[model samples]
Target: MFDFAIVGGGIVGLSTGMAIYNRFPNAKVVVIEKEETVAEHQTGHNSGVIHSGIYYKPGSFKACFSRQGSQSMKEFCQKYDIDHEICGKVIVATKQEEIPLLENLYKRGLENRLDIQRIGSVELKEIEPHVKGLGAIRVPQAGIVNYRQVSEKFASIIEEHGGEIRLNTKVEKIHEESTGVTIEITRGTIKAGLVINCAGLHSDRVAYAAGYKTDMKILPFRGEYYKLKPEKRYLVKHLIYPVPNPKFPFLGVHFTRMISGEVDAGPNAVLSFKREGYRKTDFSAKDLAEALTYSGLWKMAGKFAKEGFDEYIRSFSMKQFTKSLQELILEIKEDDLIPAPAGVRAQAIRNDGNMVDDFHIIMGKRTIHVCNAPSPAATASIEIGKEIVNRIPKQMNLKESKESVQIIK
Candidate 1:
């Protein structure tokens, strides 16, 4: 029997595996991934922005882990010699009314204790010449990196430390009781002392199977992006974003300069047909049935009808997407945008129509289920894993080593 069985192979799962291995070096640990490789879901399809905890609530898990993860992630990258960049991102306010909202974000950044500065149009031009904004907040701590690379490196470290990572092994069901837990995978039954569910898009299903009642159901929101044409690649210097509307759940469509030197324009969040659906035609009967049956989704749609309508429009019409982008840069035309890959976020929404805004984790007898961890979860994976490891019972520690584990943030 393995000491610990981790469900999912995304950044969170792999990081959690590494954390457990670090704590109990001799203990047997195994990570089960349904897909063929790690980070092939949300972590793979992400925009690759290293968030600075600016938008998260102060004192929240998202803020704490994100801040700590930012530093620790950079450290891990440096130690392993991974390719990453600390290029700053700018939150721009193009409308006069948005100035106040931008200021509010700046205040939140201060509360989060981030290194940021509010600048005028002149200062903004000094960094991103092609970008336009009346006022903006420059978050110097924000950066970008391919999370897929990070997850792969984490798996390597886990194996080097005597952990097992099994891919292409879909977890069919989970049975947990007082005598540890039994995970039923496609291959065979694996008995584990503990189970950690980090199944990104399918996390809720896994949790429900493990006998955890969740008020919220996972809703798939597909964010479709467009890459800037080769000639217009110089349109963005760092990252150019429009001040977000406070009521909406998503950050408005904006421009992001990927670490690969390609400028991407998009990520308009719209309802998706399938949970992992990257294309329009991709559909899953089981995933779709759960979504339609959930009353919370309808309630959410009713509450944000206007935003939903706008998102649907942008999802189908390229002109509408360009129009939204026009708020940040006037020179961007419809022709400058091309079909970029899309990513679907597994946003957890409660029965009352309220989306779980913070990082949520539910602990059980021998299991820890990560029900809701999106967006900044990738950026904060390291710190979040550390926090999870700290929460594990001290009795799980088998090593006689007396070295104190440093817990930052």
Candidate 2:
């Protein structure tokens, strides 16, 4: 029996697997992913911005984890010789009213102990010359890195420590008992002394399968993107983000110079019919039915109806998308943008219609399920892994963990 069987091969799972093997040297840990490769879903499709934790509420999980995760991720990248940059990002304020909100974010950053500076239009011009803003917060510590590469490194470290990473192996069912948890996989059954459910996208289902009453439902929101034309790429020096809606975590569409040096704009949040749908036409009947039937989705839609409609407009109409971008860079036009790949966010929505804004996890007798982890999740994966590892002892101590003898035929 394995000491730990982590569900999901995304960044969170890989990081958790690495941490477990690191913490308990003698423990047998295995990470199982349904995809053929690691970081295929949320981890792979993100905007690659290493969050500074300024936007999150002080003392919140996202705030603490993201601040430390940025340092941890940067250190890991340095150790592994991965390509990364501490190239800062500016949160621009296009309107006068946004200045106070921008300053509020700066205060939050200070509370989080981040390296942040409030800059005026002159300094903003120095940072993003082509951008227009009344004022901005220059988070010097904000950086970027390829999380997929980081996930691959985590996988490598886990394997080096004699841990198992089973890709293309999907867990079909999870059964929990007093002794341990038995997971039925595509290959064969594995009895684990403890199971850590880091299954993104399908975390709710996995949690339910493990007999945990999930308080929220996962509603997929597709964030569509547009790549700036090569000639227009220079308009964005590094990363230029608009002041995010204080009510939501989705940073408004802005310009980002990726690690690969390509400039990508947009990522408007739209209700996705399919949980893992990357394209507009990609549909899953079951996924759609669940989203449509959920009162939480309807309620959330009603609350943010206008924002949702604008996102839809940007998703379909290039003109609307360009108009949004022009709010920051007036020189950009419709033809200056092209469609890029989109990302699906596994947003946790409660029945009461409130969005879970921080990192949420539930622990059982022999299982730990990470339920809600979005935006900063990629940045906070390492620290989040450490946090999850800390919880294992309370649920099931690997040093003393025992398992049932049930095996597959």
Q: Judged by lDDT, which candidate is best?
A: 1
Residue pairs that clash (backbone atoms under 3 angstroms), model 1: none
TM-score against native, each model: 0.97, 0.96
Total colliding residue pairs, candidate 1: 0
Q: Which candidate is the best by TM-score?
A: 1
Q: What overall lDDT, based on C-alpha atoms, would model 2 receive against the true structure? A: 0.86
TM-score of model number 2? 0.96
lDDT of 1 by residue, 1-409 (tens): 9889999999999989888766676778999998888999899998998888988889999898888888888877777787888988999999899988999999999999999999999999898887778989998878888889999998998898788989899888889877678999898899998899999888899998898889998999999999999899888888888888899989989898888998889888887889999998999998889899999999998989999999989999999999999988889999998899999999999999989998889988888989999779999998878777777755554672244242122
Candidate 1 RMSD to the correct structure: 1.7
Candidate 2 structure quality by residue, lDDT tens digits, 1-409: 8989999999999988877766676789998899889899999998888888888889999999998888888878887898999889999999989988888888888999997889999999988898998999998888878888888888988898799988899888899888888999998898998999998999999998888887699999898899988888888887889999886657889887899988999889888889999999989999999989989888888888888888888888989899999999999989998889999999999998889888889978889999998879989888888789888855455453232111000
Residue 343 error, candidate 2, Å: 0.6
Which regions of candidate 1 fall more than 4 Å away from where they truly are?
395-397, 400-409
